[model samples]
Target: MDNSQRKLGTPKLGKWELFAYGQLVVPMAVIGLPLAIYIPPFYSGTLGLDLGAVGVILMLARLSDVFVDPFIGRWSDRTHTRWGRRRPWVIVGVIIMMISAIMLFVPQGQVTNLYLLVWICAIYLGYTLIEIPYGAWGAEISDDYHERNRITGSRQIFLLIGLLIAITVPIVASQAGSGATAASAASRQAMAALGWLTAGLLPICLVILLRSVREPVKGHSVPISFAAGVRVAMRNGPLRMILATVILGALASSINAGVAVLFFEHVAQMGSSSSVLIFALFAAGVVGSPFWVSIGGRIGKHKGIGVAGFASLAAFALVPFIIYWVKPNYPGAVFPAMLVITLIQGFSIGAAPILGQSILADVVDLDTIRSGEQRTAFLFAFLAMVRKFFEAAGVGIALPVLSWIGFDPQSHANSAGANFALTAMYCLVPLALWIVSTTIIWNYPITHERQARLRAALDRRTARRARVRAAD
Candidate 1:
């Protein structure tokens, strides 16, 4: 909006803005779609990493995030440039991610034990560089709570589309082959192709976001030091609650991703088609993104999140009993329950990222009013750190558990240990994490009324400053 036309409660986003925001979601694939869901099993089965080693490698990568994400967010916050603070970092990050994805698939011969570890580090570093800046940008672009939801929701829809395409392509390639053995080989080749396709699209998305979105004008000065910005954000109760919920919620979702494939393939023994079904389940979450976002705005962010979390908890809780009860008595029932549970999990997790993130924007504005600083990017870095930590922790736990279960993936569905491991991973771990997240969110303090007051108060201050400059 033009300077004179802007007012409190003004719609901060237009069609173009929403489009650009949606476009931003494309890059989420660079960081999210692969590692959290697809890569662990891919590395273990395809690239020849053992389950235990794969788990350790993932843990190390997540630990690295603790060190890098905050610094990256701080850098994006402190940067002053014509391209805007978050955009420049995003550009750098995208380039890094593209390189990492390429490196991820580079064919490796039978190798030393360290092969997976080395590649995982490269992948983690690349993703952290890209995602931290990309996530931070979401908060910098809009101050409206609902607008934040719209932008994030639109971004999520395209993100899910990217995920669906990435996932389904491999399945289709596998199916096109002449036989079962050939199908697995064909699927691998298709996966490589899909990686390259995504690599190609990454730059296109970067250009679209760079050319399309304009960062909103800042009304007041804020210090840029990392320590100062973090201090400001931590002091806010509402932001802290949101950050805590995100951390716990992300942990649950990450654990589910790490384990779901194992669950379907081993415990359920549903065959090659199960991969496609699982992908569909993951895609289900993405499809429901807009619905979740709208729900958050219509009710409230906390209430919406609480509802989603409850659904996820219930669905995951039932998975174990369902698997045990129906797998022997009624094999057909297993697949449907698996699909339903995963869909519920996806819907809840997908909504959390979009809606929980919108609250971060509100927190930044509230901080701006209370402390007179605009350090949205830096504040969000803490949230990113928490998210990264939990994803790693999930992998850390899953790897060893998978090992203990004797997940001789080459053996397929006959391994009892593998079957038990899958059930534990998908059903139990997620339920525990969901419970914690729900509790944390129940007491979250940023109501619509409180946020509106913060916005109105900030607007009046800006108006007064404008009048002073005019009189002078």
Candidate 2:
């Protein structure tokens, strides 16, 4: 359970072992999907916080990661504990996450924005501690491209399973008490249950992952200074492009998520059944992840992601048109079309994270060639900032736009312009970004052949270094 794990060296992860390692993502994903999709609305509808205030507070909390994540990543890299570099941070993170989850989510009385902000900050801090280190560990555990796809794909599948669980909570609450649209006491209690479930789940899974998996074999590392890490992180060409694709893709997805509930409530009018639609979308991602991994193996990861972006772009572009066409006698009909389009988009969802992480490992491999060290921790930390920034940015933008379009509490029966604003933000804006991300990712230089060559060269370098050490 401690640094004694470090001496076990790099062990080949078998299929069941991979499954156990991936199982750990479920707890974090359960926490994550709700944080992005549910918590803001939970605060606004149930707790009576203003939309803008919630947006700003959440944005600030996420923005703090721009500064905080690098240090956490660096600390994990340098950590030489018996529990291994990643496990200690993950353990501490789980405790903080549990405490914060209970305090922020299961409110007994009136709570202030300040209270919400403080707890949100704590939750995100713990989230960062776990996610950044854990991601680095995954990258370190493998060098084979197809094998990594299996690793990341397995983890992504678990993540989708968690999101599916989070998605069901609304339906459970709706049937138990007031219907889902109202955000009533039933819904609040359901969310409270979710928090406690996550609190219970994290420790169990943390124990499983630590006992099951071990880190990769690493040669001597000339510790990367923060300044040097920053320089390499910036100077690396593919990393920059990868970061760009990640940011833009996240921006698009986040924008769509920001207005999804509103679109369901005001425009589509799906009511409590909204969770079903959301669940379908995520379920598709679960089914599609392995397919994407296979496709990435066939093509390059970057090109595979481009195909996903194109598919997502087409899906989002069709959304408003479907809504527009279905608005009158067939307003309910739009939900089916939404499900189909989102199912198509789900292919992209599965591809993005799996390939993004896989490519980061590839990029880190190249960085190791140059710097003579494995720096997965800080490198992945940089990627995490891109994802966090866009997630916050998307929500931040959506809330203000709603206010500007005259969407207030009484305005669920929104004006034509307000409706127009919702559709445009929900569909077209994301569509545009999706196009850009696809274009950028399509030409990304790393290919399967190139990665093979890179690995071969690195092996030769390692053997030469070993020969030199033996002579000394």
Candidate 3:
């Protein structure tokens, strides 16, 4: 909004407060990255579970989140506590998450599919508990359009920091000829260290946020059944567009992540260099966060996200060329080429989600303005559900497809055909998903100007209610 018009109850969180709020996501990324990239390999590659079976188990377990996320969101909205709605859930979720983080990562065993399923479900459940409500909390914490962008971006920076830390472990271990070696003493020790770090950090981060960042007071959720809430959520038009964006983005991202270790290890032949490439990728994100926040401010977050999507596509376009041309002919240049590509891709990777999330706050505002109910948590929860569903589906398909294409990590040396399959899985699938995501978000309905209008109208109605109550 211009200087002439600032909406009431527009939150202005200071830098430190925003930092405090964003810090909680660090350990989350540390724990979560393994689930997506490392732990799957650890199980299928290290523990000797069949790839197809691991994929199925992972899908079913994480898929359980679709049910739990919305319920938790609904419960979060309905809760009334002196500590506040989201924080209570945060506390509970973090405790569950820390315990499960240890379970998922720290185990040394003759790994059973059942054991994997149980802990994966526990981690997903705990993650959902924190992530959905936590996301909703950020949505409600501020009303300013650009300020919300700043909040999401700031948090993303810290998320990248955690990622860099988490990813650095494997890179360094590999340099020492130890980590990501798969089913080795050094690998187990490296993973154990990561587990302990995650378990240790989850609570510390949550405690800082709980002590520092204040939750905006909210009344009980609109009295509606979960069924009705789903209907209401569906009826929100802009939200539907955003949901499509989330799913498509999730699909592209999950596929790339699920395939990353294998693709790098075999196709790109990155080997010990994989970890370094990952660290560089997220480091690029760290550098890109503010650039994206600026872009959001200038062209608006939707267009900004569109820009990011296109940028990501452009960067991804280089992947195949790098794999085919650089890796085969100029072997040493492969790592450097990938380093550049991932860093550039990371720039957009850094931007798209932060912008999408920032845009979601505005979209949620549109929902509140239309429905006359601030059902933030449920909407965020539903978005989380869609994302998880797609992520599970993508990984489920991607992993099995890898096996079908002869990705025999057991053999530790894939054939040329298998490497080609890895290239297609890594590059082509994600390229298609990114294009779809870009198209989905290209004409997003809510803009900054529009969001300001909605917020002002809501403020006027809120003032009217206060006056009526005082008169009574």
Model 2, TM vs. native? 0.94
Q: What is the lDDT for 29 in model 3?
A: 89
TM-score of each: 0.89, 0.94, 0.94
Predicted structure 2: lDDT: 0.79
- What is candidate 1's lDDT per residue for 89-176, written digit by digit as tens? 7777667767766666544565445665666676677666666667667665666778778877877777777777766666665556
Error of 2 at 322 (Å): 1.7
Q: Considering every candidate listed, which one attains the maximal lDDT?
A: 3
**Positional deviation of residue 301's Cα in model 1 after best superposition, in angstroms:** 1.2
Residue pairs of candidate 2 with colliding backbone atoms: 2-82, 2-83, 3-82, 3-83
Kindly give the stretch of ten consecutive residues in candidate 1 with the minimal lDDT sum. Answer: 178-187
The global Cα lDDT (0 to 1) of model 1 is 0.71
* lDDT for each residue of candidate 2 in 1-472, tens digit (9 for 90 to 100): 2323443123345776788789988878777777776776778876778877877887888786667888888888888875578889988998899888888768756788988888888999989988989998888777887778888998999999988887776557655655445333225777786787788899899888888787654565677678887887788888888888779878877877777777777777666556667788789999999999999999889888888878877776877777777767587777788788878877568887888789888898788787777778888887888788888898888877877777753356789888888778778888888788789878888788888888887778888988988999
Q: How many backbone clashes does candidate 2 have?
A: 4
So what's the TM-score on candidate 3?
Answer: 0.94
